[model samples]
Target: MSATPSWQAADGCVHTGPLLQSVNGFDVVACEACGFSHTLPLPTPQELEHIYSHEYYTQEKPLYIERYLEDKAWWDEVYAERYERLEAELPAGRRRLLDIGSGPGLFLAAGRERGWNVMGVEPSERASSYSREVLKLDVRSMFLNEETAPTLGQFDVVNLGEVLEHLPDPAGMLRLVHGLLAPGGMLVALVPNDFNPFQRVLNESMGVAPWWVAPPHHLNYFDTDTLPRLVQRCGFEVRHVETTFPIDLFLLMGHNYIGNDTLGRQAHAMRKTLEMNLRAGGETGRALKSRLHRAFAGLGLGREVLAFARKIDDSPSPA
Candidate 1:
């Protein structure tokens, strides 16, 4: 722990909290007001624009798109689960969806397959182009902001998967989303569950660096507890919060994949196999697997947190 730094949030709140760790010269500290940790000295908006728009998929994470396609089967299953949750919450006829930071648009494509009017907002030109030209999906190649949001119109559900953690102002982004949704519209937000108990065990016992503290890319670090609170603060009523498998358990078990890409792939494959096997093992196995994941979430011991929330009815009418 080091000296806490004074930081200001998007909502004008000042935070000077305990230092968590430093990565790439960026200090991550818990926000005294928001209760979540974020990288200090936030990257400028222009820096973020250049990074995500041009370099994210091409340079920073070159294998991201390829790996996504490689694991298409599992990814489809994951997307299906999200849609099932959204469908369960929304009315039968309500199938309009807007996926913020839609990435390669596989999730939107999945929604379209299920009869939903799906649209996406992605900043990356390469990803957006692939979604439109190759996948033939309607996607806007721009960041979601005040100007861009008004043009997309309203949606019955807004899926913010793996998007919030990258933003400099997560709560502000959610407030924008609150206005984009119809009354009682669902919001499916998925983020990496950093600083969980499993991660602590790995860091303390195994003496591993805080590998998840990625700067310039992941500015905010959130867990199940902090995420739900942030969503509620942005005018949404949380309905459910569940977590995915705790993959860090493998790292604790001596399969250290910190810098080893081959080992990392193996660990990911093992996790996928566990879930896919349960899914393929008939209805009873699927039910059991779902229950197991819920239990993990309850204990706050998962690799990712998937929260479902609905816009509070008292929200202003969409413009």
Candidate 2:
């Protein structure tokens, strides 16, 4: 294999290896001028798959599944709010939606109720099986790539909520997804914003890796700066891109300050404290905090992002 040129990260400094995992003797260091993080020697697709498919990610802990199902009922109710905002301009005539990494089929379930033909591609047996059993979703146990690409027909909308960060080559994967879409189809993706304040506090002030910085599992960390470019490279023109992540910060702080051992007795205690913190914050305090967090996010301090786009007539035509 030939060595590739090191990426000059959004941060001005040049980095060469995986920023997330130190296992390959690859590490990330920051740029001085701007604060974008960069990793060394970008990972190959094979390395990325191994890390993602590692037991930690693919494992389906019953506790987590149960907790998410309980808490995510709200998301189920609120999901299409974004698409609804742009429904007038969203793909019309036909809508076949494909959700990559459709954990428990939340989006697909919601989309189905709203009249879109929906399917999901997930590698985890537990998650996909549960989606079929519980949501009655037509999800398949497949990973996105050349082999699976030809099987799924053209879709009207493809949504990848919080799924790109885990991939080895998001741009390449988007190419496959774009190919799966019919002309004028839309692609919506959500990615982590590395510049989120909580992450900044952990990395800059404390000099600790953001616990979210689990390497191998997450090979590509994106923010507003790199996202549009990545999507455009995959052959989609920007439609409407809005980046917001206050809720994610709340979750990240809970995980960091409260706890990480989700399987432990400590997690039980921490989760209670987290609930109390929200309750004490009060109904008004809660909304106020979310507003303030949004202000911070508007200033580009939030930890996650959502981008929406539509297929353009010209795609530089995929090979």
Candidate 3:
């Protein structure tokens, strides 16, 4: 591991609030100026490279790939809603998509099936190989940075699903994505909802720690308010923002399924079952679920925060 660097905010300030808590040996603090929470002693690029390349899927969570494949039906329903929104927002015939951190090409496969030209950039060799050999998709076995962006060309849609929270410098990543998008193109990002008020209440009620705040893996934390603001600050117009179902509701209602492996798995299975059943109910069920999702998002209590932004034709270059 590289030497631990001094604490700094996205704007380059060195001052920060007192330690919020320590997770996995890294100190967590809120930026005094921006009010965003992040892990102190940020992991170096080399460490992150090694983690994502060698140990991410295999060791970090051994069953991640298998479980991801097992939940395809549920994930497909989520992907379909995102793609439908993208199609409705953009004019017909605009189909090029670039999925950053595309794991096993699920989203890329979903896009391809919907008549879009899809490409992926993933750092995991195992994942890249699977995407190519199994799915026969176009994927680059590397990370997305300024150097690699030119090689991929511009894209009509840039998808960053579940990616922003892992970065040490998320603002820089967003600016880079801004450059890759074509004029009037859209960007869709999904990030975990951390340090949320509802989750805090649930944690207090259950007398348990905040299980979602993992360090090294999840370096940045953002809620519904801050996420869209961050995107707009990066030179994109915020178009839409929504949230996934808040599983914390079960905890608030006295379920307390966090530590019990069986209960946790059952909760996840229940979510998948509900989604699959609704999707099987045809258009009416789909529409009803969509409205329900919107309502949940409006309440600002969801497991994940989903936001969509567009690069305006006359927007200035990202700073």
Tens digits of per-residue lDDT, candidate 2, 187-268, equal 8888888646666666677665566565555555677666776787678887655554343344444444434454333444
lDDT values for all models? 0.88, 0.64, 0.84
Q: How accurate is candidate 1 locally (lDDT)?
A: 0.88
| TM-score to true structure, per model | 0.95, 0.74, 0.92
Off by over 4 Å in 2: 1-24, 29-38, 41-44, 47-62, 206-208, 247-297
Report how far off residue 265 is in candidate 1 (Å): 1.1
RMSD of each: 2.1, 6.4, 3.4
How many Å off is the CA of 97 in candidate 3?
Answer: 0.4
Q: Compared to the true structure, candidate 2 yields what TM-score?
A: 0.74
Q: Rank the candidates by TM-score, best first.
A: 1, 3, 2
On residues 1-319, what C-alpha lDDT tens digit does candidate 1 reach at each position?
Answer: 4588876756566877898888898888898866798988788788899999889999988888788899999988888877887888888899999999988899999999999999999999988998999899999999999788899999999999999999888887998899898888999999999999988877888788888989989999999899999888788889999999998888878899889999999999999999989988888988898899889999998999999998998964332
